[model samples]
Target: MTERLMNTLETPCLIIDAQRMDRNIQVMADMARNHQVNLRPHAKTHKIPAIALQQIEAGAVGITVAKIAEAEVMAAHGIRDIFIAYPLVTASKIERAIRLSQRIELIVGVDSLAGAQLLEQIAGRHGHSLQVRLEIDTGLRRTGVLYDQAAALAAEIAGMPHLRLTGIYTFRGSLLAGKPTLDIAAAGKEEGTLMVQLAERLRAQGIAISDVSVGSTPTAAYAAAVEGVTEVRPGTYVFHDRMQARLGACDLEDCAGSVLVTVVSRPSAELAIVDGGSKTFATDIQPGTEPLQLRGFGHILELEDATLARLTEEHGMIELGPQAQAANLRIGDKLRIIPNHICSTVNLHNHVVMQRDQAYKRLPVLARGMLE
Candidate 1:
């Protein structure tokens, strides 16, 4: 599409290049097949069920979500297989979990024996059983039981009445970004090795661990090839963001999603503001991995060598760097910005504009903000 046509569209809106997204989906799916791992692309990034179906149609076995509300949305949209990769321990969420199980194949993540017991009790009351995967904290230090302590928890959950221990999983998202000097591939290999060792130990303890999953867009491309890993749950590969590019996961051209904003003002020779702000672009900073430094909130595609200084609720401050005299940007000039975090930025928009074959179409973000 031409700049003229893009400018005619509304500002503070999202635009997705369909061709680029299709290519991204195919690339990740093929990577999984080559490594003999099943692909379960996470739906949390692009909560639209249609995109999940597109993934399923492209050799993905299922979809992964982060919350019960997200899983319920997928089930309502006819998605049958789902993995809620979150430690769901609250009582209110358990009732909704039961409802989702009745409608589809649901696999949940749990890090505690108490959480498993709570789910087991509810499943028993509904005359249902829950397929659960124990979350192992490889190194992120966020959620999940420690890797060494997983076997004991696995044994306890496997012996429970209504909850079955189907597998072990981990989300080492923090390790995906590699600095120019760091070895990212080695990190992925280490993660796979840790996961495989834990799975082997559980098998020896008489727990039939079938699935061993690991994920994150930065490491996902190479993680599938790891032995003993049955599945991968990468969410952001569908819409490569600036962070992915900064971390060496994808190139700028491969990023399909961008926040289209019009130049509202050129307050100074070096600074220009846009209609999109923190509310639109989100304030998520790129991962601070050593050797790979990202200096701004986002990158302006049209403004070569420009920096996004900061963003307020209604304004995106763009400070033209030393090269501004070269790229030459002016007021009323529309631009596309690749946000630091695509998932959070996507949730802020009600809909997105898709570009296919030089045409544009609007699609509602059906599952946006389904936080319940």
Candidate 2:
């Protein structure tokens, strides 16, 4: 950002570098293209319709969202092709999905016969054939069905009166077996291989499996390389975070979104407090986590010798290292902090400041808190 523009901003702000973000988007798009896999970047990361459209224009086939409400928000903003990556169980939610499917190219996820049956009953009554992707448990162990039961469940879902099982997907971060590992390529390749093999098995049984989608930002690149995989949905690449940088997904310079805050207080030579805290940054990607071993709430760009050691509702405690103590920092100094998890941090804000060259614009976080 230009210094003149920077002086006009308020403290505890969310700023997105448009040029860097566009580069990040294109890089992911190019990766998918080179591997011949569809790039369906997840919209859950930014939750901004403008950003989603930017990704689509860059090369994304569509956008993937974690909730139907988010899909609705995206669709409202002229996003036609969407995948509800999560399973919708309630009748009202399925009804919403059915309504959404009527207007655009909609695909929902199904991991069980029960979920699939509910969709079938509702869609059948509505006289609509709802398209779905079978979510198989490749090892994330969250919402997907077990690998052993995938074939049976998929077969059951494929036979449903109003449901069409056209694809299978799994979301496993950089993990091997069930444990996190630094070997992202191996984990990604494994994810793609598992999904592709499962798709082949289902196809052999005349199930007409078409899309074998897999991957998050950490795994999208390698997974897309696997021959039979049809699509990859990587969310965090749009604004690479500290966690992604540690995971080797991107360099720290690649991080495009950051919290801009002013030094609020200086309690001691080693302790400088910022205007942003838990209310400004995400707390989910906590410090001292395994695998990555992230040490702080965020990475301070200007002060590499300072750590965002703690945060309350509106106070960020920056523990200045020995190198930082000699710098003689003062109050009212602005600092840009790259949060550990930009996606969650984004949910806490109503709008983000987009910067390109010296120009700036405020974009609403339209899909924020659309958890339902």
Candidate 3:
């Protein structure tokens, strides 16, 4: 008989600490409450419905996702309140989004007049309106309309019969990068200030704003405290990753997810190869205010100075620094790795072997590959 379930399981699998995850969820929920804002954490982090329910039970007002397919997955699992924190432009996606709205309290992110028009067309065909939060560009400069341009767009969107301009949101991803004197409260304050200013601009034009949302796990803790930030959409706080630890979003012990891999080769004194590779880990570098040109793709928990230096499709190359060499790892020895990006890392896996009270069980990544 197998000595234990873990011993019989394959390497290169995803493992999550259930207690750590619960604490992370509770803390974020409490933080949002203390800040007097609703916690609508992004679901793209774990993509697991059980965790989503855990968050709701912990006081999260709703769940947020990056795609309509993710929302569909959540709805199938009976997750009724969802915010698609991404812009939907394609017709097929719009049609699907409309159908999803029929079954849940759905809110989507919109940035452009063209996107608004497209949503309008979808609503016209479906005979129902789509609720949207205007995405505001607050410095990280990825998506969303310019802050100055929001008022006019709000006015334009309000004219569309099939669309309802619900509120405004922004992503200050740079704030997650730790500063020597990181004032998380201040970051949240600024984000709240920016979003509220834009929301007020819309309200001045008679737009009834209800959801003033700001996001990214780095600022979620503090963003909720902002005077007008109605909700926070932090995703990665559910499964704290190395990036979150390095950014000071959470302590290293708070990271709940890791990739379990077995050492497969020791070809050199400076490097070791592992069964896990790029396909198993994520290549996303840490994002924040400071340029975290992080040196490695992932960090090995067992080897203090070992960096998952590089990864190909099927193999990971670990470069051993002086301290890492002390571990003296051998072939067949297994270790855990904290990936740089937890959200993308989870997407690469089909399941997570979760540990609770020292017992392990599995949970499906139901939303994985839901790219539609």
Candidate 4:
């Protein structure tokens, strides 16, 4: 589409290039197939059931979500197989999971024995048997049982009456020895090796460990190549972000999502203000981090020399480079910005504009705020 056409559309809206997105989906699907592992792309990134169905049609065996509410939304939209890759610790959430299991094939992630026992109690009351995956901390250190205690915890969870322990999974980025590293290949190899070894040990103890699920977008292919890994859960690859590009996961052109905002002001010669701001783009991945060293909130597609330096609630501050001044950015001029993190940035919008064949269509972000 031309700049004139983009300017005609409303400001501060997400624009997704359908063709680029489909290619990303196909590439990841083929990568999982090539490595002989099931592709279970995490729906937490897109959160739209329609995209989840598209992923399923492209060879994904199932989808992974972060919240029970997200799973509920997807299940309501005809998605049958799902993995709630989060620990449900409360009676209400566990009861909801039990209810969902009756209608779909659900796999819940359990890191603590207490969480599993609660699930067991709720499912038993409902006369249901729930399948579960033990979350092992292969090194992210966010949630999940530590590497040393996984075997013992797995044994305990397996003994529960209503919960069946079928697999082990982890979500770790490029890390070496529990510290972030730039060598994604090595990090992915180690992640796969650790999970596979633990699965073998669990099997030796008479536990039925069928699945060794692992991998993020950066490490999916590398981790999937390991001998015993059965599934991979990669979410961000469907809509590549600036962080993913810097991590070497995808090229800049591979990114399909961008916020279309209009230039609302020019306070100074080098400073240009946009309609979208902190509320518009995600700030989780800060400008300066060790490995990636990302320097901006988002990347401006039209002006390569301009930097999105700052963001308030409703304003994006763009610092123009000396060479970019010739472009003469004026008020009402539209700019396309690829955010640092697409997943969080997506949640902020009520709907997104899908651009296909030079045409635009609005689709509601159905699961945008299903945080519970």
Please give the clash total of every predicted structure, in order: 0, 0, 1, 0
Q: Write the per-residue lDDT of candidate 1 for residues 75-98, one digit (tens) a residue.
A: 899899999999888878987888
lDDT of 3 by residue, 1-372 (tens): 113645666889999988899899989888887888899888888999989988999998889988999999999998989999899999999988888898899998899999999999888988998898888887667788987888898899988898888888888764432332255567766787888888887788899998898867887766676677798888999889887787788887899998888889999888889999878997666323244555588767857788877789989999999887787888987888888888999989999989876588889999999987
Ranking by lDDT: 2, 4, 1, 3
lDDT of 2 at 182: 84
- Give the Cα RMSD of candidate 3: 2.9
RMSD of candidate 1 to the true fold?
2.0
**Model 1 TM-score, all chains together:** 0.95
| TM value for model 4 | 0.98
Better of 1 and 2 by lDDT: 2
True-structure lDDT of candidate 3: 0.84
Pitting candidate 1 against candidate 4, the one with the higher TM-score is 4
Model number with the top lDDT:
2
**C-alpha positional error of residue 213 in candidate 3 after TM-score superposition, expressed in Å:** 0.3
Query: Whole-model lDDT, candidate 2?
Result: 0.92
Ranking by TM-score: 2, 4, 1, 3
Model 3 stretches with alpha carbons more than 4 Å out? 1-6, 175-186, 286-290
Cα deviation at 79, candidate 1, in Å, is 0.9
lDDT of 3 at 202: 77
**Cα lDDT listed for each candidate:** 0.85, 0.92, 0.84, 0.91
Any runs in candidate 2 off by more than 4 Å, and if so which?
175-177
